[model samples]
Target chain A: MSSSLTVERHPETRPPEQRTHRQVSTLPLVAPSVIALLLWMIVPLVMTIWFSFQRYNLLNPEAREFIGFGNFTFILSDPGFWISIGITILLVVSVLVITIGLGTLLAILFDQEFPGQGIARVLAISPFFVMPTVSALIWKNMLMHPVNGLFAQITRGLGLGAIDWFANFPLLAIIIIVSWEWLPFALLILLTAIQSLDHEQLEAAHMDGAKPLALFRFVMLPHLSRAIAVVAMIETIFFLTIFAEIFVTTGGGPGLATTNLAYYIFLKALLEFDVGGASAGGLIAVILANIVAIFLMRSVARNLDT
Target chain B: MGTLEMTRKNSRKWLWAVLGWLVACLLFFPIFWMFLTSFKTEVAAVATPPQLFFQPTLENYVEIQARADYLNYAFNSVAISVGSTILALLLAVPAAYAMSFFPTKRTKGTLMWMLSTKMLPSVGVLVPVYILCRETGLLDSRIGLIIIYTLINLPIVVWMIYSFFKEVPKEILEADRMDGASTQQELRHVLLPLALPGIASTALLSIILSWNEAFWSLNLTTADAAPLTAFIASFSSPQGLFWAKLSAASTLAIAPILIFGWFSQRQLVRGLTFGAVK
Candidate 1:
């Protein structure tokens, strides 16, 4: 996926006059996308920032006033805000650890010369295609339900009582559901990376009598390091903003157990109609996302250079 | 080299295959379970010690269409996803073409900046976007969803298409140019055909992502413009368990994209990773 820039300077490429003419034509062609994205990024962001400082509510539009950090102060002092931050970190970290760890193992395993490998891999990654709403409901009702769920049936068969996953462990439930959806993504990326590994390099390592674990640590793990990093960073960006799973499964409750920043803001903006408060929360989420985005952008920019 | 060693190797191969299949089935169980339940009657769906064998019925699927007007939501999903995909392509093809063929010092920065916009948490702008939509009376409209979907996905579409366009050799275009071909002629005759497969895959990815998108579809629309995402979410209410109906709806909702996803699995890595992995 290296840029085509390297190829253009080949001696037979276009003449300087034609190149300049094409460059001149490029602007009009690219302007629409640039302008559209600029508006899309700036307008809502500016509105959110402006609303964060003002006392605005959808229910009482005429009562708007400049509150000047009041919304932030309230959000900071609120216990739910702190709890949601903790839950957000927990969800993102746990999902990353599970997906990346399990993904690497699955990638290596499936990379082996096993019969039906292609079909197995296809089935394994199908969950990535399931929409968030459906995945959550499938886990909540079919697999995790206390009474009639598959897990309940298994537990009861073992003479144990059925456990209500949402009621008992809301955050864990969200983590499992989210992990199921994302593990496939990590696996897909890491597998592609691993397959690109030089077979001669692996054979040379094996010839040196490196044990299975040692070979994995020295050869495969190092080869996978960049892919794992990419997967982790990309997953972090998405996981921080996970909403529909909590919305469908727990509704951010069992007393604020599963409400990440996204759902928290959604509750404020829509349910409470507290536009100022939600906007303040919204800015906080954006700031958090930007912190992660900086690292991701830097790494992806490095790829562009290659 | 002995017979015993050959037997041991074959046994180990079988073991690995079995283990692989087991893991795959475990991961695929929930989706397969939903598929199975969709064919069962509602009562049998929730039956204790869930039924593995039963007289399969299409009642649940029938009920979904008759009671919920399933086709309306399906049509919305198709229109929003396909409409947004086409709009995104229209904007992206030109931009990607320019960026790929013409090198500028800022081109990389421009591409990176566009992707960074995608990382802007949707919730961060939810409050304002919702308000803006309401103010313009675009709320709960297909056009509204299409516009928002296109914007949200524009960066990815541009990035993917850009990478694809970068794969086309510059000599082809230059040769056409030397033949006195106009810019439009060069594009039509030289570029589009070379890049059509990439563009098609990009559009497939865009449509898949748009179809499965829950946030905007859930928030921005209700009955009038609700896509399948919102339709499935409606089942999350604490009403009596319609497990069979929910499964049927879910199966219907995901079937097309699931098949699309399977066919495009290889491209998924390239498209989703912004061409970094590939």
Candidate 2:
């Protein structure tokens, strides 16, 4: 059914016998991957469903029994769900704002012909490749530590008080760290988009007496819309599941200040061993992510289709 | 001539360059600080005034090596990353070639669906995956990590290789086919050369993904096959920051990939932007 309705591209010059066999089997050659993926996908999903329906707790195997909707109900009543939801939304939005906002501006900036541009470009993009755990540790130990951190040293030198980033604003701290890691990726994508923009069109705008602000508003922005949308979508997908940053920084501590959905589920499964709660929470998180994804993909796909 | 206007344009360019430099520094400062701290003594690393001109030493690097068997962890990282990338490429190349050159009706949906798996929070199936690994007796092994990384990185590899293969003119393949070339010959002589850059980038991307992959590494690896991520994490304890040793460990862990990325950044930049932008 899928093969019948989809846009398939077969090599044009297969032998007559080969074509006959191809005709016999209408599905494309990529079926192996699809089948592999289906198995990989279905097995886990089925396991999750099975686990969710049964009363499953890691510590209480003998007491485990079938309790349909019981785990789901308990999950619905748990107070951490609301708190984690709120935190997840805030983390997602804040990281999105900071990364994309800074990324756009940096992309425009780096789009200029500056000295040491090679090294500067590399620096701007390096954070993207750094592992999340390393970034968190670097931020936690070297930069943001209250007593011996770079921030503390600088503040004291400048005749100011040292702020404990974790203690004062744990969620904000996590947001900053994640934004740092992802900002470069956004910058690179947007910069590529900016570079792909038509220089002649900008010159034409200038010839028409359009100022810098007018050119940016009318010319550069229109070209960047799709790039921005792509960055937003991809970044959201990653940010929605940020585990290492929270795991390393606060470990979702100080009363769950920085616990997003991913880390919350992590705590449930790994720490609390609440398999049912974690599975249901994960499913809910996936749904929440998909909502944003649908809109993001539609816009980007529209651009792609063009 | 418009000499005054030319001077104004030059001045504006200079201002923009300055702003760009400022932005670059803001972006790069943390990494710069990490490098700087790597050479400082434990006390001096945390000292006030930031100790810009301290008697630089490799004390941390020494301590870090003494603390843990660094070579063992580094070797695991190398083996696992390289091994997984090769495995992923082997599977992905055939699969991607099939899809790109011979897309079926379900191609678009299938590709999108594969990509969507990446969207699923990895932690969602962490328990099942961990349990499966344990039950299968694959936990804490290099091969185990390789299998996991290969699966995680396969979707992207397929995506990249598919796009790369698409860029190859379909007519090229037909010409080969009309000449009565076998499938193996056509692929060997035709597709490989044309898509080398893409394949190289894919390999590089996979290696980097595996190298820096921390979550599964942390959860799955214990002692023997634990990679550098866990080695760095061992420095982290409830006791708080051990600046010099942690710095040394961090630097050692990140340096190889950093250098590798620097060398391959151009290909990487293009690869990362594949289909998303220019």
Candidate 3:
């Protein structure tokens, strides 16, 4: 937190009038963002909690009443709720593993001196920029469309029989799509982290007869632990609520196969119009995300102090 | 040394280069394929074995324009993303300015708390936001989306701008104050000019995030305010192989942001991780 420049003077050395004026000026400057965020956080949250306890359904407005923990109990007992939670964890963990695993290798690969490396890096990272809906549609139709998809063509050519990706492997299909979108993000971050690795250290390791695997194991991986942690934590928070890909691709179907927590809440709220049920589901998601957020905050907070 | 050793090293370099390009192409293939399909006839787009070389046509792009007002969706996307970015900057820049320049004991905690709010899942409040938007007559309105997008991105905007401002030397601000300049004058004339590049990159990052925001845009908007994200979602249903038009639309929807993303790739790491890595 300490800077080379000492901007803050001792209180007695500075004019009292100027100090108070500066302090007062900050309140107005900072108040708007704070107040807006406070309301944004509080209003919807309070309503979600309130509605979670009530017997509110958009279909039966007259049936609205104090339901106490009925909504929570209902959601907790539902098999679909547990299934969605499992899928959510699976999706998050799977994508995290694939992206970080491939990302580390790609980062090391792309980090080396190569012709057209700039263009290659740009192309490699391009998927990260794509809108989720667009990426999902591209995968769902063009690449995974069973008979006419590119994958089918490739498979048929190889005489291995075409695989109907979404139909046969709904969750796996989604995992692939989500990983494609995020792998570039992992690459971008890890590459930046890898670039910061000391070249002389690598040279020294090479001089000591370290093999490539040994260099990666001893030198590179340790340097990347913090960055990897950042990628995992940030990706987890986003992946837990991956709605658009599911919304556009499977519609949470093959009967809740792709219904992660976000899609589950959407189904309850919009599809079924179960206000209380969706609100209860929403709270569950919030709790799950907060667990990951705690670790992310700690890692990020460390950066702040430095 | 020896010519044999020199050739081996050169070959190894080429090997890495080729491997690097192969991986890059594999990753970029889907987008490239989408781009290629955009120009093909609908039949050719889904042809068995997939037509790599085909007579390209603008028919899909033209058909898409006629079928859906593609420009309307594009305009909505631009306006909403740009609107939200500007609004977030308006709110965040001043806040970040105050926090960075006039550091207090509570500033770090306040910043951290702001970021924690961002970690709250959007679905958690979907019901309430949906009902609230419906009740306030704001659902399907660009203003509603603009507001939501602004709030969603405000934390990162504030954080990015704060880090940027922190990098500015304090001596310049102190020098400005010695000349009897007011705080506003100090910010506008002195701090603003110094922090302009960082601010510009911050704006670019904000614009990119806002432009590609899917969750709120998908849930809240149906038609009138639907951005490209929602607009593209309309292609989800199987309507007897309209892959060509879908490709055209998808390509257009993602083109602008992808270009922006390429330009901001370096800033992305810094902005996304809230300057933690950099």
Candidate 4:
């Protein structure tokens, strides 16, 4: 492990006078990374703005022209845009509700000193480690498939015909897939937050004859507010751009029922090859997602201070 | 009365434990079923009345191997995941180290900016990035996949590593410098060793993210550079659906990462909750 650098035995702190220059040298260290992100991120973001103003299609290269917000207008007017927005909202909200609900419950369960806690914790968090595409495929195929899926098997076991879940409940199916991938993350964070809770407060609540729900509401909820908010913000930020899940499972199928914002932009570009319209759509989605993210990030940022 | 109350609480505890396992089973059964069905024949797989306890066979896996040599893609997955993580760490460690130990007004802003890059829809730049990759001859290559994944995982890596680095005091590095250790030497001897837990955790977390990454891997790599995710995707095509085979592919894809996650559940949980709770 100690290959190159020999450890000098004497470790001594530098004087305050000499430390300022040493600290200032950090400027050079971060510049390359910062500049790379700016060009790679913000520049393309600005180009998206530019493309939104033009009429460009990869299919018809000659049709490309400066449309002066025409692309944005068309993009906004597209019927799929609003539908996708609604579906995106539905996707985000449902995932949050399910994942956070399961997360907190599992966190509380794992928090208790119990036998097999280690294995339960492991099994509980295993879903989060799955690649999104693979998870979607698994859920779509062997789990939710009307014929061969376990969902179908279980249904038939109950003396019912198999349920075509994606065909019938595309949005719900997508919600479950994303939740399976993210629930472990929420659980991990929530459980950590729970562990940080003061035992004294819970003991006091117990002494005061507080019911379990009352103790959870009064004693635990406030303590968890920041962690919960962080969890919500983190999940929301990632959930907004979930593409592989939608792409893999339903492919926005069952008549656009599960066309989330990310998949919509993907379809516009990849399937339709409408570069300008898709770019505009991408910008629109960025704006819409940013509106949600900026608020969440702001709250998390404000909380990060304390 | 108190003894009765204690008994009530004990029974409730048992109830909660039972409830927890039940929930865990429901959540995990899909995976369990996929593994189970992988051992079943395609006929038994799609029988009208599904059977859970059929004689198992390796037919699906054998057929899967005939369809595609999975080991190659699995190897690519291993290479791409480890490669991206190492590359991301090479870049992010120094950056995180400098920012965490050396405070400035813009440090927080820089961190936020890095993380905010993730908010941008990846598909927004898909064509451009795809074009760049094509022109640069990086598309459908392990190097290319590694670069894309490194960028995707970089922000979180820096944030996690920075937070981990923050837990190590600046005074230690300062001490190293005072002992005539060069800036590079100080980082190597003091910062690196002291931050090994954070580094080890950062490596593990990045590996997990890269291993589980799907969007870029699917869109970017097709055959030559395809990873396990794409291996799973090959089961899907315009030809028609192959549910049993698809399940076999996906089960194979996730099994490695799931096993790793199960083994390191504690560390993974700790890393994911880096600054979240504290």
List model 3 lDDT by residue over A1-306, tens digit each.
223244544334556787677777788989999999999999999999999999999999998999899999999999999999999999999999999999999999999998899999999999999999999999999999898999999989999988998888999999999999999999999999998887899999999999999999989999999999999999999999999999899999899899999999999999999999999999989998999999999999988841
lDDT of 2 by residue, A1-306 (tens): 111233434545466686665444434446556666666666766677777777777887677788888877887788887888889889888888888788888888888875677787887788877777778888988889998888888898888989899999888888889889888888888887788787888889999999989888989888888788878877777778888777777889899788878888888887888777777776777677778767665653442211
Task: State the TM-score of candidate 2 restricted to chain B.
Answer: 0.91
Question: Residue by residue across B77-175, what tens digits does model 1's lDDT show?
Answer: 999999999999999999998888786777888898899899999999999999899999999999999999999999999999888887777667767
Calculate candidate 2's fnat.
0.41
lDDT of 1 by residue, A89-132 (tens): 99999999999999999998888878999999999999999999
Candidate 4: where are CA atoms >4 Å away?
Answer: A1-14, A303-306, B1-9, B170-185, B238-244, B263-274
Q: How accurate is candidate 3 locally (lDDT)?
A: 0.92
Which stretches of model 1 miss by more than 4 angstroms? A1-13, B2-9
The candidates, ranked best first by DockQ, are 1, 3, 2, 4
TM-score of chain B of each: 0.96, 0.91, 0.95, 0.88
Model 2 docking tier (incorrect/acceptable/medium/high): medium
List the candidate 2 regions with Cα displacement exceeding 4 Å: A1-29, A296-306, B263-274
Better of 2 and 4 by TM-score: 2
Question: Compared with the true structure, what per-residue lDDT tens digits does model 4 show for residues B1-278?
Answer: 99999998898888877877776777677777777878877787777566779998877787877867877898999999999999888888878878877767788888878877767767677766765687899989999999888887787788788877766765576667668998778878887888997787778888888988787888788799999887876665536656667667778888877887776565665455435455
Lowest lDDT sum, 10 consecutive residues, model 1 chain B, at: B169-178
1 or 2, greater by DockQ? 1
In model 4, pairs of residues that clash are A12-B175
